[model samples]
Target chain A: MKQLGLSVREDAVGNIFGRWVGSEAELGAVATGSHVDAIPFSGKYDGVVGVLGALEAISVLQRSGFQPKRSLEVIMFTSEEPTRFGISCLGSRLMAGSEELVRSLKRTVDNHNVSFVDAADSAGYKIHPDDLHNVFLNQDAYFAFIELHIEQGPILEKEGIPIGIVTAIAAPASIKVEFEGNGGHAGAVLMPARNDAGLAAAELALAVEKYVLESGSIDTVGTVGILQLHPGAINSIPSKSHLEIDVRDIDEKRRNYVIEKVHKSAIDISKIRGVELSEFKIINQDPPALSDKSVINAMEFAAKQLGLEYKLMISRAYHDSLFMAREYHQWV
Target chain B: MKQLGLSVREDAVGNIFGRWVGSEAELGAVATGSHVDAIPFSGKYDGVVGVLGALEAISVLQRSGFQPKRSLEVIMFTSEEPTRFGISCLGSRLMAGSEELVRSLKRTVDNHNVSFVDAADSAGYKIHPDDLHNVFLNQDAYFAFIELHIEQGPILEKEGIPIGIVTAIAAPASIKVEFEGNGGHAGAVLMPARNDAGLAAAELALAVEKYVLESGSIDTVGTVGILQLHPGAINSIPSKSHLEIDVRDIDEKRRNYVIEKVHKSAIDISKIRGVELSEFKIINQDPPALSDKSVINAMEFAAKQLGLEYKLMISRAYHDSLFMAREYHQWV
Candidate 1:
């Protein structure tokens, strides 16, 4: 930021901002930036493109001698991936005034039992667990926010399209379920007398697909992303099984319905297999975020002027932009 | 054994033996014993009962002033649970002259990458990896062998029988399979475009049950003992999955048929899901061991004389007895 001749500041939650003061500095700033965290075993292209692309765009505009009426602020959010805390958009959620996030932060600990506040403190970001309002953005802090990201799915490449304007981000709900059963020697336990937890997990995985497909909507997607069996020896029956399920759709009600069906299926499968439904936890269920019409129109006009064929599509993958839309009046 | 006035010694591979010399010590000895090792998180009764019971039987005969024509030997086999080296009946398999075990020991390493020879050395047992023939038993070493063990299955208790005379031990086969597919963001990957490896694993698990049930034999049992998904986050599609399946039956041909059907189902499921079957490994498939008729008759006559109700049943759970039968001329 110093090299770029812009003033810089980092917020309480490590959200970095670089501001190019304009003539009317008192007006709401035009903010544009994205996160830079990548998940494990992931590529560099995920969030890297968004953050680097935004910086490149600003550098190009400055070189072309462009002047803005409102202050142009680049905001780099933190921890967009759930790799560390098992929750996505942590920095954006704080800025968006998520009360649930605030409540969770009080007790939320990572796999290593490190509290979020302690982790931030260790990273040179002091946080007051009881008072986190400093991280929340004011209602009219931004005139608009825009983020540039590469397509995460195959749709754009399949259709030979160069650009895609996301109209809405899908609502996502995460669930974790575990089943417990009587495990025994695999060779000794007869099939008729066995209550295998691994099989219960398999049945529920298949059931998730059945319920999602039965919803009769292509937009409704469900995934049994994680399935694990306990005492996982080749000659021992699984006494316990765990599953982490992800369900999403553009329609909030439809997604919730699917989640309910999945929950019911887990219970039914457990009972039928003579196993116990030990846990059914819903981590987070966020509402869909719609793109502002004014921002969409402006992007469409720019794409048309550039003679770039672009498609207006819904983003099934949630991003920091999804949470940002809750705080800002307009976003793209 | 010292307190009981019996000479004791530990052989190569840690097979402990307590011998009570009889009048005709040169005559072939009567051997009776079992393993004392148990798997993780298991009960005290598994192999403990067998070892303690054999000791009690010897003490009772001594108290009765009984004199044996031949020597009576109690043996405690090592590493019968496969908890460390992933091979059960290790001591007995070596004594039974298993060339495969000797070959594997040259390079076989545990989860910690500790070689078998290194582990033995650490355990205060000197193993000449190149000269393991010392562990092999002579064909005429024992006149007869008998092992006292608690029933691993429920048939004896369910039928309200107090004792059971062994007829034969069931054959057991272990298989490990891995499937690989394209993984992406759970929300971003549309249902139609997903080649989910986790789902393929679930399909194969269900297929195991189906194939076993289709065999039309109540004695046939199969279990998907372990299932795991890689990159197992809630919102990431599984790119790879692994499964360890166990199948067993008293009939070798029938068990082999089920195993073949399971293999075909795995390939079929992988093809249908557009996933790659990266690994299909059969760890070990041993044939069933039949009890000697003379030993069975002697056990029946003793039970009748004692007025104890007993049933003749197959031993579904393999023990050191299974491997011992390979070398012993007669066993019960």
Candidate 2:
């Protein structure tokens, strides 16, 4: 921040902001940045690449001795990974007036009974209690915002595309389903009398695969990553089984439809086999985020101008851009 | 034993022999006995019943002032269940001059490095080392051998029949199979490109059920008692799985044929799915041991004379009689 002659500002929620005030400082700032925080064991490329890329872009712009019409800012948001406090983009959400929701949803970090308020109070921002509500950013002052992030999927690498202008981003909505049956000695129980939970789980897994494949395999993907059977001994007929399922697609309605179908089939199979089934939604996040058309066009135009290969792709994994695009921007 | 006018003698291999000398003591002793040892947690009826039944029969004869044409003897064989010492009919096999096989098969009992010979020597049997060979019972010296054992199956109970005269004994021929496959992150891997070991294992389990059911279900039975998977995690595809398989039938040829079919199908599936498969014969034990026809006829005749409902059925399990008939009296 000092090297670029930028002024530093901290939000009440601890979001760091660096402002390089142009002659038209009164005008909206053209923001270019990404979240600095990362998930555990994945700090190398996930958000770091985007962070460095944004800083380098800023440096390049500065060294060119060209001043932008609008002021420029590089902001690093806090807690982009939900692993720490359950919900991601805590700083952005707090500024966007979702502070109460974040507070209500959060219990404690590290199970230490440290409330979000308590954490923010001691986050070293040193903001007065009255200033906590002043964390909201002046969105009207920004003409455009862009986040450079890593592609978490194999799409770009497989296609040999150097740059990707994402049009949509996919987010997960998950469910946990369990089937209960009566277990018995495998040999002692006759085939007809057996209420095998493993069989029920296997059939459910296959059904999930079938439904997902049938519902436009390219658009939606459903997976039973965890299929746990109770009393998993071979000699003992399985008594209970459960699965942790994840389904994702760019279209929220399509994903919901597939989820409905999966739930229906599981229910039908459980009823047919006399196994008790129960399902609960663990996560019901927002629909997929579509990128700003003007911003996407700008990226495409720039790539074309540079004679670079690029793919107009959909992000199959979540990024900090998802939260950034919660509201419309003139040039994002 | 002294009160009952029975002479107690100990074999070199620790077999307890109680003899009631008759006028024809010069002739071979009419042996009537069973093993006193049983598998863990089972002592109510197994060998105890047979041992008591033989002694009761002898007591009844003594009470009736009966003079046997041949000398009568009741012997309690050792370590018949095979769970301990890892050998069935240890005493009987030793008496049959299978001392070398017994010694070779013997291991530390009770997790202690105690040898079988050491156990026998310490078992209160005061015998000269030179007389160890004398422990081999002369089959020609006995005209008959009878062992009355409790039916260890539900055949008699299910049929409501009081008596079950076992005509054959069934033992399992078991094998262990392992399937190896490539494991990867569940979410990152596409369905078509992924080599899921859990899926392979699940399909193999279903194949086992299918193959066993296809074979003559009434005669043959196959079971997978243990299914172990490596790095069992929800987010990771299973990399390896193993199963402990037990396949058994009365006819050795039929059992072997079924085993061969199972092995072939597993191999074929492994090849088709690109999963590495390996199977080894952990136990290639012999098939059912048919009882001596003369003894079966005598049992049937006695049940017939008593006007009782009896089933002269083949034993779908093993007993001391299987080893006793190794090389014994003309009637067993």
Candidate 3:
């Protein structure tokens, strides 16, 4: 970036900012960039595309001899996937004055024995510094935040579109449920007398899908992504079934509503099947964000100027922009 | 057995028979015994108790000088649990002119790479040597075959009975089903677009239980003993489910009726859920056995003479007596 007349700086909390240095340096800068962190087993195209896109745009502007009214800043937020700290948008959370809230969140990352704080500390991060509450760019640092990122959904590829304007960001709330029933010798237990946890669990899993479909919500989804049956033998009856469930939607109420139906079904099944059941929410993240109309319109106008076909999309995967939008109203 | 003045002999196929010299050695023996082998992770007292009970009965008869016109013999059939050879009542199967039949069954023992024959050979047993139609004592060796073994089911324990006289042995007809469907990221896949094999398999399992219960056959029972989901993950929709089903009853027609109903259910579910479904019967041991009426009556009379409470029972577990009864009409 320095070769293109851009100066790079790192914040106290380690957010990276590259400045193109417009003549009017006093005015707040226009920011366009994304994080560089990734989830496990994922391709490198996720956040890297956005960060590199900003660099290329700056290069094109320099070659074209464009003079801006305000400086253009490329900001790379840290740990946007939260795979290491166990919280998404870790840098954005701090810069948005959520340092205290994020500090209180407890998690285990990579199935490691250490807590989230220990891992973050080992990676050279601290929730709060003595001098400042918001260690990186605060809510008022940028006039507008526009990120260029590769769409992670099937829509763009299936529709043959090259560009997209994100309309809203869908966040996740996760929970786990455990069902207990009597285990027996698979053959020795008569069908009528047997209380099989595996059967009950399978029934509950189906019930989850049934009620979700029955709700008739288009954007809503519920998943029993992880299931473990106790004493999983070819010939032995399962005594316990453990599940990790994830429900996500752009609308938090809709997500919670579907989860309520799931809880009700579990209760009914437990009573009918004489199986003991228990469950609790492990994650409760609320305040889903809608894209700023002005920021979206700007992206659409840019696409129109370039004569590129584009679609209005939603980010089912939570991103740093969602946290940034909490304080900075002009988020893309 | 040596303390009781009994001589023991092992056939070429390793069946053990202990005999006390009778006044007339030419008369065929009244044989009472059972195999001492057990299934994996089972109680040691299963067939062992029966073998020891015969030995104790012989000791008592010797103490009382109870010499009969027919000689008394104690027989121990090998591989009765069938875990090692994958064929139940293996010794009896060979002795009842089923040496050819036993040779046809394929099996893997102890999760090893070798076939049942290889395992048996490694343990020192050869099949069909010249000048011998059968390696062990054939059906003609015993005049009356009586076996004393423990009931595997909970009937006696639940009914508060001290003794049980098994009247019939139920045989199992086992089948395996595999369902294949498209897998996807659970969150990204829309509700209507999913063809989840997990849900299909769960529905089919429930269908199995439903059909059996609705059939209203008290003696009938079916089990989905083995279930395996492919790429089982909390965040991924399941693509395949494999199951091993066991349906059993003394009445072959009724058992087959339930199994046929289950197959019909699988077909309906496959069509409804748009999953690839296939199934095949792995075991079809047919021609169920009923204990000899005279033998059951004699056991009942013996229970009455001892003033011990007893009940007529049906054996859900296949036993050596069932195979022996195929040839020895007087077998109990």
DockQ for each model: 0.59, 0.11, 0.24
Q: Is candidate 2 or candidate 3 better by TM-score?
A: 3
Kindly report the interface RMSD of candidate 2, rounded to 1 decimal.
5.2
Task: Flag clash pairs in model 2.
Answer: A28-A141
Question: Candidate 3: misplaced stretches above 4 Å?
Answer: A1-154, A162-165, A185-188, A226-228, A233-237, A278-308, A317-332, B1-150, B280-282, B319-332
Candidate 2 per-residue lDDT over residues A227-307, each given as its tens digit:
666665433456777666667777788878888888888888888878888554454455678777888889989999999
Comparing to the true complex, what docking class would candidate 3 get?
acceptable
DockQ for candidate 2, C-alpha atoms? 0.11
| Candidate closer to the true structure by DockQ (higher is better), 1 or 3 | 1
True contacts kept of 1: 0.73
Residue pairs that clash (backbone atoms under 3 angstroms), model 1: none
How far residue A51's Cα lies from its native spot in candidate 3, in Å, is 11
**For all the models shown, what interface RMSD does each have?**
1.5, 5.2, 3.4
By lDDT: ranked, best first? 1, 3, 2
